[model samples]
Target: MQLALSTLGCPDWDLERILSVGRDAGYDGVDFRGYRDEIDVTRHPLFTDRADETRSRLESAGLSISALSSSITLCETDDRAAHVAEARRLVEVGDTFDVDRIRVFGGGDPEDRSRAELARAGGETMREILSIDGAENFQWVLEMHDAWTASDDCQQLLDELPADNVGVLWDAAHTIRLADETPRETLDALGDRIEYVHLKDAVYEPDHNDATDDGYVYAVPGEGDLPMADVVAALRERGYDGWLVFEHEKRWHPSIADPDVALPAFVEWFRDQR
Candidate 1:
C-alpha cells in the first residue's frame, strides 16, 4: 500500500505548494479538492475542462491524483441535477488526469418513505452514472458518510444496483459517527464492495454542535483514543491495500491544527505500525 496526504491538510496553500510539500515530505499522492476559495476555478485549469493541464502539474510535482475530493452526493432534496452536472465535470477532469477514483456519496434518505420507490430511483441513478461514457476510466467509490452509512442503506444501494464502478470508501471517523455496527461488521457487510479508504483521528467533542461535536473533530492520527491501529490491522486483514486519506478539516477547524505539521508524525506512526 502507498501513503498519501490530502490537500485538506494545507487548505491555505495553493495546489502547487501542496504538491511540492507532499513530494518533499515523501508522500505518494494527494486527494484533489476544487474548493472555490482554496483553488479558484476561474484561474486554475485543474477545475476547468483542462485535464491534461492538471495531470501535467501533478506529474511535474511527482504526485498522483489518488482521488478527487468531490462533492457529489446523490442526496439533497434539491439540486440533484446540479450535483450530477458537477459530477460530470469532475469526471471529465478525472479522465484527463487519469485519476484512479472519484469520491462520491450515495443517495440520501428522504424521510424513509416508499422503500420500493427509493430503491428504484437509486438503481436508475446508479445505472445512468455507471453507463456514462468514460466513467469507467475512473472508479466511483462512495464514501460511507452522512446518515446513509447505515448497513441497510449501504447494502441496499449495493444490492439494488451493483455496478462495476460502484464501490465504498471506508472512512473510519464517518462510520464511527453514522453506524451502530463496528468497522469489522460494516466491512464484512460491504464485503467486496469496498474500494477506497480514508484515515483520520478525532475526539468526540461536545463543545460544538457539529457532527464532530459528538465524535472526533479532526484530531491528529493516533492522538485521539481511537483504535486506529486496530482499524488498520482490520483493513490489512481484509487485504485492503490502498490509499489512507488523511483529512484535517482546515475548512471548519481552521485554527485547530494543520496537516503539514501533523504529517511527519503520522508517517512515523505508519512506519512504526509496519
Candidate 2:
C-alpha cells in the first residue's frame, strides 16, 4: 500500500509547508482534510480561486492528492441542501486535482434512531449528492467514525447506497478503540468495500485522558498500544493496495507529536512492516 500524509496532522502549516514536509518525509501523496485553519479546504483560496496554481505545485512536488475529506455528513437530516452544495463544490475542487476519492462522515446518533433509519437518511442524501453531473465519477467514501465506527454499522449504511460509487473509509483506530473489533473482524465485515483507510495509533487510557473522551490517547504510530501491525497484515492478506493515510490528530489534540515528527515516524514504522 502507498503511504500518504493527511493535512489533519498539521493544521498550523501553510500549503507550501504541507507539500514540502510531506515530500521530504517520503510520503507518496497528501490527503487534504483541511488547509491550515480552514477545515473546508474548498473555501480556501488554493482550492477555489487559485486552484490551478495549487495543482501545479502538487505536480512540481511529485505529490498526488490521495483524497479530499469534506465535512459532508451523510446521515444528518437537517441542512440537506447545504450538504449537497458542499459536495458539488468538493467535486469541482477534486476535478482540478484529478482526485477520485472524497471522504465523508456518517454523523448521527444511533441512540436517537435505529441504524436502519440512519442508513436510509444517509442513503437518500447520498443519492441526491450523486445526482450532480460529475459527482458520480468519484467514489464517495463514508468514514467509519462517530456513530458508524463498527463495520456492521457502516455496512448497514453502505447497503442503502448504490454499490457502484459508495464505499467505506476504514478508520483502523476507531474500529478497535470504539467497536472493540479486531482488524480481521473489520476486514471480514467490510471486505473489498473498504476503498480508503485512515491509520492512527493510540493507547487506552480509561481515566484522566485529556486528548479524547473515548478513553484513548493518540500516540506515534508504532509507539502506541493499537494493533497496527495486525491491521497492515490483514490488509496485505486481502490484497488491498490503497492509501494508508497517517491520520495524526494534531489538529484536534495539540499535545500529540508535531507533523514533522509524527509523519516521518509513521513512514519509517510502516516501511519496517514491509
For lDDT, the strongest prediction is 2
lDDT on C-alpha atoms for all candidate structures: 0.69, 0.90
How well is each residue in 1-274 modelled by candidate 2, as lDDT tens digits? 9889998899999989988988888999999998887899989999889999999999988899999999999999897899999999999999988998999898878899998998999999999999998999999988999988888778888889889999889999999988999999999989789999999998877574455877788888898899999999999999999989999998888888888899989999998997
CA deviation > 4 Å runs, candidate 1:
35-44, 49-53, 110-116, 208-215
Cα lDDT tens digits for candidate 1, 1-274: 6778876666677767777778887778888664436432323565565656766888898888788867666544365676666667767777666778888776566576554556566666656666667776777787777656776776666666656767788777667665756678877888588777777777677664443646456676778756678777888889988888776666666765666777666666777776
Candidate 1 lDDT at 252 equals 66
